[model samples]
Target chain A: MNNERILLVSRPKGTPAMSDFRYEEAAVPELKGDQVLVKTIYLSVDPYMRGRMNDTKSYVPPFELNEVISGGIVGQVVQSLSSDLAEGDFVIGNLPWQKYNVVNDISVRKLDSNIAPLSANLGVLGMTGLTAYFGLLDIGKPQEGETVVVSGAAGAVGTIVGQIAKIKGARVVGIAGSEEKTAYLKNELGFDEVINYKTDNVFEALKAACPGGVDVYFDNVGGEISDAVLRLLNHGARIPVCGQIALYNLEKMDVGPRIQSQLLINSALMKGFIVSDYAAHFEEGAMELAKWLMEGKLSYKENIVEGFENTIDAFLGLFKGENTGKQLVKVAEPENV
Target chain B: MNNERILLVSRPKGTPAMSDFRYEEAAVPELKGDQVLVKTIYLSVDPYMRGRMNDTKSYVPPFELNEVISGGIVGQVVQSLSSDLAEGDFVIGNLPWQKYNVVNDISVRKLDSNIAPLSANLGVLGMTGLTAYFGLLDIGKPQEGETVVVSGAAGAVGTIVGQIAKIKGARVVGIAGSEEKTAYLKNELGFDEVINYKTDNVFEALKAACPGGVDVYFDNVGGEISDAVLRLLNHGARIPVCGQIALYNLEKMDVGPRIQSQLLINSALMKGFIVSDYAAHFEEGAMELAKWLMEGKLSYKENIVEGFENTIDAFLGLFKGENTGKQLVKVAEPENV
Candidate 1:
């Protein structure tokens, strides 16, 4: 049988183009001992992936030229050689961006579809969900009645972050690029205020929205939007930096007003973190997130695109502010199910 | 009796000039109930005071125009009507830039001169020491064998910070402007490395000095120097921003490469604080610092400019980086002592 996969053909310059990626087809390898043949159903495309595309040092190593891009993938066990897994079991793992993966059973964790939808295992119950959970609770630490501002509020982590801040009884304010996103955050997500960064003056809008001043800033889109939120931080405010999507595609070093003075005057704290930093406590965080979901205290959205060929488009759409929430590409159906 | 006091006659536009201050004479007031006459002996002149000279908001309130400038002052009780304070008692308080101040006894904390020099109350074992203690141990949290980089490493706080990091068994690198200052840090203070920022290519020197990367950055001088140190941070590094003396006098907003990306990729933390932020635990910090001093694990230096007439000069000299350590003005001799 044939397997289709995407390869990073070239390193992107300023903004990535279609020429940077290439699609290839190869024979599906036979499984070895304890290995399972899993058919990929869905794959996640995130903003942080942009950092891995550049040939520079980051939290994660840069993607090598012409290598298969790997990320969060949800699949079903179509064939198993060991007793640890069986056909029809749904699973999730950090897998290559391909139609099928033949790997050792230990590489993926089996997921119970009864708890939540299988696709959600790639989102709210997965990486994006955990990212929002730990970043908001651990770093942001939004106290009751304290104002919390989140940038990229319409995206995967930002949407979940605002919801979690609201759950913590914080006065939640969100910043996004569209009217639809602002409306969704305010009207649907129970956000106290929402600023459309494309239309409104962010700094002035933030000042008007956060009358008490920002106490926790959950930053996803860094740059000018973060600059505005930072200016309104009260004494002892905390900023949890999860992503700098705004500057991810920039060809040069990003520059702005130095923030140390602002931080100094306000006695504020700014910390950068990845979800894996809380890996030891992921079970605890996931449990709480699941409980919140079960109790209707948490909600999530997914903007899934159909077909494996569209994965590159889905990934590039993140920079253009195209997706509203978790952007995923659905490649195939669960054959066993 | 007459008292000579310095007043902020005008708000400084950029770097403060001597013309911004005025020396005034006033009749000494009588000590009322619980009031004691404090004869200013050793008054501290610090870089943080520069922030107060501006009309803009800061951690401390801006100095009101034509009002007396107040700061850390070590004085002797010359006259007292309060039963709580006795004549000849040494004390430290946020007192005015004056030859004498008649204030309530409760306003000043009595100092034990036998423990250390009375001027030590304004430097090590006092504000600067406590600043270093809390900022380094609490925020910087340097672990044994880790690398600590301190900017303005010859200043009052920086000197103490490097010593404290050393006590923690960390490899300490000090960055200062002059060769003399660097020599003092490396030869006298036992810093692992010293970089004269003015003479050497700081980025290259820091790279050579910190082969393991920086785990803790005690940032006393912010600007380009900090930018260089920031680039060399290890994953999970902590930066305790103590002062921004380098940018304090800028006529316009200081701009630099936005640091969020650096902090993000490394999952680092940067916090800003004043010594007063840890006031609730000041005694605990001061006690530890005092113990270190008594054990010979710590040492301090003070550049005392004689006479009250040189107070403004001593303060302005901080901008010029003329003083090696704690800068103070000796106002008068203790009459009772």
Candidate 2:
């Protein structure tokens, strides 16, 4: 079968553009023992993928030019050589932005749609959900009555972070890019306060919203937003940094707010977290998030575009602040045959 | 009795000069109920005193111009008016830079010289010791088989930090000002390695020492030294900031070694801690530290200058890096009694 794939054409200079990706058609190879042929159904386009596009040293390696730009995907098994994953099985795996993938079963996990929608597994029950859950509970340690301030609150991870903080009984303040996103955080996600960062003076608004100073700061959008929150952190504040979307788009020293002195004076506890770091704790985190989600105690939304060809556009949405929640590409409907 | 005192005279414009203080003699204070007329025996010289000298907001209040500078002191009870303390009792308490003080008995804690030595109560066995213990364990949380790096390694608090990290089965590396101090950390204090910040490229030396990348960073000194260490942190690293001796004397804005971006990429944690924040857990921390002292599992040194009049010289030694361990002014010898 012919497979359509998105390959990294070049390393982005700044704000990863659609031109950096090249769409092409390739031949699907035969599955080896213990390998399953996965037909991509829902391919996730996340901000972290931007990190892999750069050759700079980080937690993970950069994606090579001319290679398929890889990421997590919810796929249907069209052919399987391994008994562990039979053909027709719906699985979630690191299947990349592709129409088809010949991958090992070990890298794939079967998801039951009856338990929750399979796509919900990609949005809230997958890495994104685990990221918010563990990062908050383990790092943020949100206690009831404490205030949690999250930047990028309208984004996928930020939305769930606010919800998780809400479930933990902490007061939540969300900072987003637009009026619409700010309203969504307050009315739909139950954030105690919402700051339209693009419109308001973030420092003054955050100070007024979290008058007592924040106990937990979940930083998704770093830079000036982080600097503003840093100034308002109470002594012994915990900052769980999961993303730095603001800095990810820098061409050269894009300066807004410098936070070094504020970091020293506030004496804030700033810790960065990658979801994979808590792999051992994922099961516990997922189960709790799943329970809260099923009970209607949690709410989530997605910005999913249709077609594999549109994967680059979905990935590029992060920098523009265009996508409200987990941005995914629904490449195809699940095939039963 | 005549009371001799050194008044603040005037707050220093920047780095304090001897001219900022003036010596004067007056009648000894008369004792009141629950009060004791104590003779200043050891006038403690510490970095935190710099905060008090400045007319600005800080953890403690600034010293008023023309008032005797307040500091931690080892004093002898000269005349007692309370049952809690008595004459000839050597104690550690807050006292002014004066020959005598009419202090409340409740304000001082009696020192048991037999536990180690009376002078140690002013250094390692006192506030500095508790600061190192609580900050490292409570905030830094060094675990076994980890690489623990401590800045200001020759200072009172930094010395204990290296030893405690060693006790926890960590490889300890310390950063100090002089070769003598560096040698003392490796040979005398038993630190695995020590870097002399005066002559070495601190960042390069740090990279060489901690090839595995730093795990627990107990920082008594902040600034570029911290910036250097921040870059070398492994994922899941912890930085417990107790003090910033380097920034204490900063005349202007820093020009180099920016660190915030490095911290974000490392997924490391940097936290600030005032020892008193964990005062509730201090009794328990002090108990363990005392055991380490008695078992010969810990070692400390002091840079003691004789005479109460020499307190300014002792304070100046901190900036000069003249003291090897805890720096103190031995105000009055017991023979005077």
Candidate 3:
């Protein structure tokens, strides 16, 4: 079968450009023993992918040059040699940026679409949800009536984080890039206060918003926003750093005001964690998040760009703050649906 | 009785100067109900006192101007009007920088000099010891075979921290400002490695010393030393920030490389703490530390300056890195001794 795929042609110096990726056609080989042939339905474009694009020692290995950029992909099984997976089944796996993939059954998990929308598994009920779940509850540990400040509040993880803090009876304050994004967080997500960081003096706005001082900070976009929040921390404050989208694209080292003294004076705690770090408790986290969704206590949004060709554009748009929620590309639709 | 006291005549802009303190003579008033007149024996000159000197928000309130600068003082009960303490009893309390102080009986704790030397209560067996105990064991929970790096390794708290980490079965590396301090740490304290940050390129030296990577960092000195340590952190490294002596004298805001991204990528934990945070468990910490001391598993040193007139000079020498261990002023000798 003919397969369309995108390969990383060059490493980005700062923000990635279109020339960095090369779209081409390739051939997919026949499935062998215990192997399954899957056609890509939806491909996720996340900020974390940017880290893997750089050749650095991080939690995950960097993407190889002239190779298909790989990430979370939802696909439909067209052919299966393994008894574990059946034809016409929908599954999700960390797969390449390609139209068709030949994989072993262990590489993908079968998904039941009756539980929620197929795309929701890529977002609110998936890695994004779990990232917010464990980072906030396990690390941030927001107490009732305490104030929680969330950066990147309109993004997938940040939206879930703010909602979870609210569910735990905290006063949620969100920091976002645009007025429209901040409005969405306050209006739809029940954020008690929202700061447009692009337009507002973040330090003053945050000080005004958190009158009692910030007790828990869920940091998604680190940099100046984090520095300002560090200054206003209450005694024994907790900061769970899940992402640093603000510094991911920088070509040079990131420099700013040091935080050790502030943390020292406030007696605060800051921890960094990835979703897979809590893989053993994934069932518990996902079940609780799903229950919240079923009870109408949680809300989520997705920015879906149609066609496989827009995947690069969708991924690049994340740095520009163009997406209000989980951003994904629709490579194809389930044939059964 | 005649009392000689030093008062904070003015606040220092950057580094404290002699003009900031005023020494004067005052009369000790008659003891009230349950009050005791205590004569100062040894005065603790700690790095944390620098924070209290500034009129800013911190864990402790700033010292009032034109008033006696109060801190840790070991005194002897000269006259007692209460049953809690008696004449000739050696006691310790947070008291003013005065030769004699009249305080309520509840303010001081009677020290049993038979168990250990009186000065040990101010250095190895007192608040300084407790600070090292809780901050290391609770926050920087170093596991066996891991590399534990300590900054300000020859200081009171840092010395104890290195000893405790060694007791916990971790390999200990100490960073100090002088060759003499590093030699003391390596030769006397049995540190696995010692980095003389004064003469060495700290980043390169640390890299060579910790070939495996730093697992637990007990940071008593922050700034560039911490930045270098942060770069070489192993995954899930723990940092307990007990003090920031490096930035204590800065007149302007401290600017350096932001650490959130590094923390995010490594999944590490950094917590700032004071000894009092674990107040409820003080007895447990003190007991364990005392056991180590009694077993000869721990060793401590103190830089004692004789005479009350040298008290200000002794405190000022801390910023200049003049002391080898716990810095104290011997205001008077014990009558019995």
Candidate 4:
């Protein structure tokens, strides 16, 4: 089969432009001893993908020039040579941006989204869910009645973090960029307070909202705004470092207010994590997250851009703050289970 | 009995000087309910004291003007009103610069440093030991053969940290200001490498020392040096923030590069801790540290200045990097415990 894939044309110097990518059609290779042919259904666009566009040694290797970008995808297996997986199985795994992916069957985990939307495997129930879940519970360690503030609180991971902290009996405060998003956070998402960072003095608003100092800070946006929140931290505060969406556009990251001494004075716990760190707890995390979704205790949004050609466009939107929740690209229609 | 105590005569504007302190003789307070009269034997002079001397909020409250400055000290019970403590019992607790302190017996812990020096309780066997042990294992979480580097390497906490990391089978590197302290780290303390920050470019020297990126960073001195170390962190590096000796003197704190992004990209965990966080782990930590000390697996040094009048001088040496290990002031004659 001829596979359609979007290749990275250039490593971004700053925020990536549409010109940085090129769409190409290529022949999909035949299955190897353990390889499986997967028909791509959906491709996940995440903040981490921005890191892959830059040629820097990090958690994952940088995307090579003229190679298809890789990220989380939900695919349907059409052919398999391995005993682990068979044809007609819907599995979720890491797949490059393509209409079709030639993957090793062993690397795929079969997904049954009859439980919820399969695309959720990319957001609330996937890396986003696990990230928010572990970041809040493990890093934040929010105690009952404590004020927990999350930056990017209307976005994918941040939205879930606020809800989860609320579930844990914390007074949740969210900081977002839009008035609509802030409304959704306060009225619908159950955030006790929402600060529109784009319009308001975030520091002053946050101070007014959280008269008690910040106890748990689930940071998804790291920039000048995070510094504002740092000042209001109570003694023994916990900051869970998840994503820094604010710096994705910078060629050289800014030197904001130095936080080391304040962190020392506050005795804060600031730690970073990739959802992969909590792989040991994913089953429990996914199961519990699924329960929250089914019971309507938590809500999530999916901003789907149609067609594989728009994958790059969808990913580029993340840096621009154009997407509301989990940004994903649908490559094909899924067959009935 | 006449008791001579050092008082903070005036608040410091930025860097504290001898003029800020005044030594005067006063009456020793009589023992009351639940009180044990302690004759100060060895007075500790720690970097944290500088924070307490300033009229600012910190992990611990700041010392007021004309107040007797208090810190961790190993004293002997001269008289007791509580059944929990007896006269002449060697005890360790927070004591002011005064020659005598009437403290609640529950506030102090009895120290029997049988296999080591009694002064070890003021450092390695007490809070500093607990700080390094728990901070590294619980927060830093060093893996075998992984590279672990610590700043302020020859100081009391840093010495114990590198040794403990070594005991955990990690490759340890120490960074200190002076060549002598750096030498003491590599030669006397068995660290894999040591760098003199005053002479060497920390970034270039760190690149040379940690060919394999630093897996764990025990940050004692947080400043520009820490910024350089953050750049060399491996994926999933752990940072246990035990102290920040560098920023204590600044009248107004200057912010460094925003490290939250580096932390996120590296999946690093940076958490500040006061050894008291693991008060429950005291028995376990003390036993393990004691075992390491008895086996000659860990070595310690003390920079003791004779006479309580020199307490401010001893503290100022910390900012100047004159102290080798634990910085302390000897107030009066020993109780001969």
Best by lDDT: 3
Off by over 4 Å in 3: none
Task: Give the interface RMSD values of the models in order.
Answer: 0.5, 3.4, 0.6, 1.5
Per-residue lDDT tens digits of candidate 3, residues B22-72? Answer: 999999999999999999999999999999899999889999999999989
- Record all residue pairs in model 2 with backbone atoms less than 3 Å apart, i.e. clashing: none
Assess each model's interface with DockQ, reporting 2 decimals per model: 0.93, 0.39, 0.89, 0.62
Off by over 4 Å in 1: none
Error (Å) of candidate 2 at residue B87 is 0.9
- The deviation in Å at residue B138 for candidate 4 is 2.6
Rank candidates by DockQ, best first: 1, 3, 4, 2
- Candidate 4: which pairs clash? A258-B255, A258-B256, B52-B63
Task: Single out the weakest 10-residue window by summed lDDT for candidate 2 chain A.
Answer: A254-263
Which has the higher TM-score value, candidate number 1 or candidate number 2? 1
Candidate 1 chain A: 10-residue stretch with minimal lDDT: A328-337
For residues A1-337, could you state the per-residue lDDT of candidate 4 as single tens digits? 7878888999888878888998988999988889988889988989888878888875677899988888899999888887888787889988788888888777779998588888888899898889999989988999999999999988889889999999999999999989888988888889999999989999999989999889998898899889999999888899998888888778775887778777777778888888888889899998999999899988988899998877877888887777777788888997654
TM-score: the better of candidates 2 and 3:
3
List model 2 lDDT by residue over A235-304, tens digit each: 6678888888887777775444334444445566778878888899889888998899889998889998
lDDT of each: 0.93, 0.83, 0.93, 0.87
User: Whole-model lDDT for model 4 versus the true structure?
Assistant: 0.87
Summing lDDT over every window of 10 consecutive residues in candidate 4 chain A, give the lowest-scoring window: A253-262
Off by over 4 Å in 2: A251-267, B6-13, B17-27, B55-57, B61-67, B251-261, B335-337
lDDT, candidate 2, residue A109? 92
